[model samples]
Target: MSQLHALAAAAGVARTWQDADGRDQVVSDDALAAVLAALGYQADDDDAASASVAALSEEMSRPPAFLSVDIDAPLALPASLAAAEAAELTMEQGERRSLPIVRGVLPPIAEPGYHRLQIGEHALVLAVAPPRCLLPADLPGVARKRLWGTAIQIPSLHERPAPYGTFADLREAVRLFAARGADAVAISPVHALLSGGTSFYPYSPSSRLFLNAMLVDTSTADAGLSDQKEQELIDWPSGLASRQRELRRAFADLTPEQRQEIDAWSERQGSALHRQAVFDALSLHLDERDWRKWPADYAHPEAPGIAGFATEQTEEIAFHLFAQWLAERSLAAVQGEAKSGGMAIGLIADLAVGIDPAGSDAWALQGTMLTGLTIGAPPDPLGPDGQNWALTGFSPQDLRQSGFAPWIATLRAALRHAGGVRIDHAFGLARLWVVPEGRLASEGAYLSYPFADMLRIIALESHRAGAVVIGEDLGTRPPGFVEPVTDKGILGMRVLWFERNGNGFAPAEDFPAQAIAMTGTHDTATVAGWWTGRDIGWNRRLARGNWHNEETQRMADRSALWSAIGSGTPQPSADTPAPVVEAAIVQMGRTPSVLAIIPLEDLLGLEEQPNLPGTIDEHPNWRRRLSGPLADLLAEPATARRLAALIEARRA
Candidate 1:
């Protein structure tokens, strides 16, 4: 191998890869160099490369601070600690054990937790994980072989004059769905976003560690604010401004005892919460969007100037802390309502693949987050030029060296108030396509991560929370990826649109019993929209694709889907999409998969999708609200029949 290729290999950068078209593609030297630099390695010259390689060698020689292994699995000790005869192990529950190390293989641990291990003078955390996540069959009180659920965009349930939905609305939704035999209500990411901004995409979160404060229910803290007429779409900028005003007024009205309560709760959140609160306050005070543009000293969370800034902005920071508290409590109430309503697995939370580079997660967790690199997909049929999501992710080396603290924290946050979590773009856990700043998305390299360790950590957290885990493993995956994921008891997603059998839709029984079946996702065209070629119209209007060809294909797809639903079923024309939508829901529900989830849009026969990929403002993405209150949502005859059909299908 060439010197650069050797260095890249050592650093976990893929030199060559297979493309979507099954063609061999090589990472350009320029791209490799840029990625290596982002990983803190100098690769401009041979001398620099040698020095960096030597540095990596030295770092590898050092023992890791932590080790993760499956329960009852023997772990090989690091070479440096192999000479030790016996080690002392301390369980998380305060129990201790002294086990002999036979030929450098530590005895298997029967329990799963963060246990301490001491060998001679060296100490490390030994994280023992269960073999798999908590599955539906494993859930207590859940006896059914097939479970059904409905997915929704949280903001789409707005029935009041608040312009956007609140947790109170979500609570009502949980009761409504649970009454209809649904076990889960999967919702979009509630992760924090840039407040008061026109863009309200949930996936581009400012911080995954905290909930979106704008989604709080402020009816009790109305503060006599003027009300706007309820509309079909959310006015995010105005709605968030009103929410901010209401929250501020509520804060001002807090008594001394209430303030003390909030202070005590904030203290329990630890340093991460403090950093997030500081970031929110400083961003508003400086009137800046990105912290990188802030005056140098105030940019970092722990810089010298940050101390004085926090002192000067005490009230502002406290207000943010208070808002977060309210958001958490509000969401908790929704989950409580779901469980109390007799749902087996309620509120399946969505975890976005990455965070906006300018967001709070990047600023607060700088020690682990990668800089000057954005994550996205390589060239695919849908995106000929490749796609850049403009999001930042964790550094593989830092994750290993830091004991996967950031990863564990993110998982806990997602699973905090939900009985399940669906990981978006789960392919990221194994490898991420990282593009350097100022480079084309096509010029990106696949950076390898510690997949085994991360998966074990996920299993550990899933068991601890007693939450079922689902991975969005839809796109092109690495070789041998699905086996381990299924072995770990993580449910893989099987979307209806992509389940093709030759030139036709696949039979419902074809789906694996271990996976979750879905009629559609937030990103895809709804069943009604697909039946009527609504997506083709949008693509044509936006010049995204050849609309003429797509329209021709849609006609054939309609017939195929109709045939797959049932023999002798007549295909519905473009003008009549309601029957198709109903059939699609029932068809997905009849799958042999563990769970079947239909989007609210499809359940209601709505023609527009919640989101149209590849468009920022061209489409009304993430802004549409449901037509009626969730309580009366089932009043629609079509919706009622479709849901009843779903329940019957699942029973089959």
Candidate 2:
């Protein structure tokens, strides 16, 4: 083997990967060197490669600070502590016990939590996790046979007072869905994005630790900010300006009691919340969104000057703290309302795959986060050039050393007020395609993660939060990925467009019972949109590809879908999609999957998707609002009929 290949192997970088076409794609030597360099390895020459390999080995030889093991799974002690005869184990709840190590193997922990184990002078955090994540059937008062929900883009609610939806609107929608016999409402990511940025993509969050303060309802405070006229698309810039103005006014008007309350709540959140608030304030003060552009001293969370800045900018930081507090409280209320209104699973929050490279998470966790690397995909059939997401995530080595602290915190934040979580691009947990910054995405290598360890941590968190975990495993998963994911009780996604049998759609009954069935995701075309070739129209207008061929394929797909739903039902013309939309909803509902989520667009028979994948500015993604109030929309005869059909099919 080449020295570079040895270095790459030592660094957990894949030397070769399989592309979407099932062909082996070898990672170029240059790509491996680049990826390894990003991982802090200097492998430009054979000598450097050997040196870096030795360094990595030395690092790996050291005992990890933390270890995650499935409950009842025997754990082998680190070599340093292997000779210890006995170890003292401190449970998370302050309970302590002495354990005998039988030939370096510690007995399995029956309970799941972060426990401290001490062997002589060596100490490590042992995370005992449940065998699997919480299942949908395990949810109280939920029927295992069939459960259903609606997927909504929170901003699309478009209620009064504010042009875009807030948690207030979300609460109303959740109640409405619960009344319609829905068990859950899977909503788009509400992770904290830029405070007043031009880009309004929810998936690219500033931080996954905190809520999006802009989504908090400040109307109750009568902040006196002018409300924009209700429109089909969200004017993100204008709306963000209004939101900031409103938040400032609301913060100024906070009573002494309110200030004390927010301070107390912020205190409970600890340094993570404090750091986030400081980042927001610093951004406003420096008038720079990118932390890298900020003066070096003030950019990092632990920088000496940052503490002084936080002290001096107390008022501004307070406002951000107040904003976070309000957002969390509002979302908590929505979850509460859903549960009280008879929903079994309530809200299922979407966890974005990664955070913006220039965002707060990147700034705060710079040491553990990738610096010169960004996450993306390798060249595939769908994206011949591959795709760069311009996002950064935690380092696998750092995660092991940090006891998975950041990851656990992120999971806790996502499940804080929701009954479940849908991990976006869940395959990323096993491995992430990492590209060197400024490099073409195709020039990337797959970085292996501690898949088994991460899965155990996820299960531990899931059980602790009593939340079901649904992995968005819809696309090119690694070989042997699904079985482990399934074994861990992480529900996989089954989308209507992708559930295929040759040219025809798969039978509803054939869908896996452990998966979550959905009509479509925010990125895909809506049912009505697909039937009428609205997506193809966008592709043609954008000059994305040969739209004529896409249109022809869509026509055939429409026929195949109609047949799968039932040939007895008359096929509707492409222009008339109401019948097809209704049947599609019913078809997905009939799936044996524990959870079926129909996007609101499909339920309303709307011919527009919330997002178009390729076009950012050209497509009004994440901005389109519902035609009317959710309650009224649900009351419409057509929507009501489709929903009723869905419920009936689920029950059947």
Candidate 3:
């Protein structure tokens, strides 16, 4: 009823929201004013709220330059366009034709692409997308009715060769797993990370637009690599320096033809590649990690000074490009090996929802990305204080103005060489919790995006890539959101820990066919850890939450999980946990879901999960390396048995 509340709601801010504990908390006026300011509005009081509302009204009242719709779908235009008599449509490939705009709706596009629409003095970019993404059954020569995969955080895979494992180790995994009936290997975000002075976690990437330079193993030089010992935890800084030195050495050894090839690849990548290279080059001179903290002269990519800087530091920019090129070649070879080895879906790439606000993506995507606000989560049962990811995301308004090119670019990059792409926190496409800088996570507002348009773009990109699309659609979602994602042929992710039906685990067969079935995500506990309450113990030890009081509930969950797995009652304790680790895999394999991916941790029955949410230094997150080499994993009896059972069930 308050004027500030009205303006906040109108500006896509949730004034009152229900927390995970089922308690309603109203958004404070300060939070509203801060979030509104980030959105380019100013509302500190009732009068300011009215002014902000008026400003929004005035801005939105202008004619938009772009609109998006699915192919053959109704193209609804604004009321202002209702008076337009005729418009000229220009397709991407230079074809142009005039069509009538009848009753404010343009004719359904027969083709999907970026097309220009002209109505006298008004011109708009129209993005028409394909109906749905590539599906499992649509893959050429896919034998199994239901597909299955194994998900792993690549860097965490402990192998003898390459120390902390490399693209080379991952390549060998395809040949080994393809024979074992694993069609896909879902990886953590391989998006380019800041090589030096950054967290090793793959989720919080510097730039989703590029590849991690250090993951590329440029060698045959190290004959003793096969015998190299693995580390318990990845020393990212040292590892990156070692890999970069090797990559530089190889680059120096390249011939004229090889140099030309690198130059050609850079040219094809165009502006996006150059922009990122510029950002990386600038980092060498600037002490500040965030571009926001940099001198105003070089803060933005498109600034006049950036071009001069790029020219002055051509070699530095080239080094970054060379690194990306190496990573790309290695990644492409892995995917090629997967397909050649008879895998239907070679690799599944993970796409982090947002980019680091201080990273290359933020520098490049100035038009489409929002810098003043950070994406976060509302207060939830898992974390009572909520979570601040401290990442920047796309601006819904600017995305439309730019015709969603940045989004399209990001998606294409992820799906380029993968058999499937898993979108982390897919609910992000619908809406995001926006927190202003210096604000607590709980004091944020849910900002809405152009969900329908973004989904269509994703579907279009998915079809073009001929890759399956999987969305990690967990957390708070808008009503009827999952259905649309599934309907668009994008598989929704379902974890075992959350798929409860009336206080009991949902039956495997009851799992939806258009989804990805899994025991746990990287953010959750492993099957072995959850069974033994190791996750709860870690939480208590790390002082993350009040998990010490949830032993009874945690045990109850263990019993329900085993009961759902048809393993009678579970008597899980510290020393002797229930024998449901492999059973859990069996249950997941039995699901009617299109694909079931078992985490590597669960496959090895590791007590320590790959990642423990909410703690960095307090816990060993993203540090657990695999027990042995890629081939040794296949030799494991658990791997053999689980793969055999999963493949047999899917085949049947």
Candidate 4:
């Protein structure tokens, strides 16, 4: 079919250029001969020229946009004068490298001294000139020091009754973590989501710049709205409803002077106000659908109605901006408390790879975004079918040409109140699989980028912010991902489960010294779930076709392999408890990896993992709340002291 169409297209082009007879009634023989020859047809040929011509015409008529030129045009460089002039211009431009711009100020690190750094899978040896500090000098004076303090999830920490409301509860939670010897608390992404009965997933955020208004502690009254009692369990729907009602009542109760003050404050932060207006407009337009499915006008962000909507939603925009300000203030307070409580690294924030295609970042920077491609993963041993995240990412060419404004802006926001930033899917710096929209993930090809340039930008921004960077270099890492990251003083992620030797899992003592070691990530099963065979069982159930049987057999093989290790007697039914897993992880910390982060769930011996990969509704993903309150967790003296001792020993 394709060959027939190609012929038809060729015939059509030949026919178009054919000359007509002098009388203009019919084509000349010479012209017909020329057309036939151009279409690869011959007068004496046995082949059917008509069928070929018809096929070629059909192909040409289908779509002109699909046609492409195949040219290898060589550059015709000018001689002497022009060449010299071009060289001179190039030299002048090369000398004028653009200075790095600072968009926002970050609070400085407490101690700004040279510290030794180790990256998980990379090695570096620095030679310093006289009067300059050497790489060894930057190493911490003590061996096996931790990169940061303990971490807790904010949502889990404050999951209590309504009277102990959002912000008030968070305040108490922060204080609790500080007293518990935690220097940092890593929380879920708090980006804004679709309001009015939407999925409460913090990750699939509608806007990266705006704060999740749901996280706003309504107890902190704005414009005279008093806190109200409500049902427990952080009922998102009811909480948003109550908060909106209170906001309306507060607006009504505000005096003219108070209204004026609010208006003045909004006027002062014009950019933030404008962004909020745009976001509100988009929310109304999108209405639970991705922006690509919207009307053509709304699809292109710069279309006429976008700016007008921003102008109309002035007060609503101000409200959103106010919410962000409150969130910023609260986070800063938490950092201050952590610092006061003797935390070395106050907050370690996670940065998501990309935003929803219909998100604020994409809307505001449409030109910088890739319109037709979605970033995803290739098929691997763990995920045989491969995975598509359904999120839009910045094109490397566009990002580079735009001076990395979008990347810089996102980093600045995350690091503003964080002591360290963990870049999710950090391998994205090298290459990203760009699957065309509506295409399968397997069809995607790797698109390379200038990794060194990107890392330089990251290092520059991080250094300016005084924040350490931990690259999540898990999964199938690309060749040479470690070198530049380590050279730039960034840390690497080390997952104990995936750390293996040729025979089986590597011993904990063999783990790298410069990495941030962990038992598992949000995507993996918890210690209890892994022990009980729940994770493998879930995987088998989710497997497609005969894959289910294959996965089950694979699990059995893994069990047998574990038995061979002689670490413990294998149960016929997998049932390794949290204590065993915890002990293994503690032994991992005893390795060279300077930092270790134990999830609070593992420490508490929870039965379920925070998230189960490959299942959305089938598994309880991001919504799991801790069984006990923050105070109860702190009061668990034996558990707390034991974990603390491990951390201290690892640092030693």
Query: Tens digits of per-residue lDDT for model 2 on 471-522?
Result: 9897899977988899999999999999998758998989999999999999
* Model 3 whole-model lDDT (C-alpha atoms): 0.80
Give the per-residue lDDT digits (tens) of candidate 3, residues 478-573: 655877787788888889988999959998888998889998989888887887788888878766667767787876776677678855654545
Candidate 1 least-lDDT 10 residues: 221-230
Provide backbone clash counts, one per model: 0, 0, 3, 14
| Model 4 alpha-carbon drift over 4 Å, by segment | 1-144, 147-151, 162-171, 195-197, 220-273, 285-289, 293-302, 540-576
Give the clash total for candidate 4: 14
Which RMSD does model 4 reach against the true structure? 14.3
Candidate 4 lDDT, tens digit per residue, 420-505?
77887888888665555666665554555557656755665565566667788887666577776777667787776777777666
TM-score of each: 0.98, 0.97, 0.95, 0.71
Cα distance off (Å), candidate 2, residue 403: 0.9
* Predictions in order: lDDT: 0.88, 0.88, 0.80, 0.56
In candidate 2, where is summed lDDT lowest over 10 consecutive residues?
A: 220-229
Off by over 4 Å in 2: 78-80, 143-145, 220-227
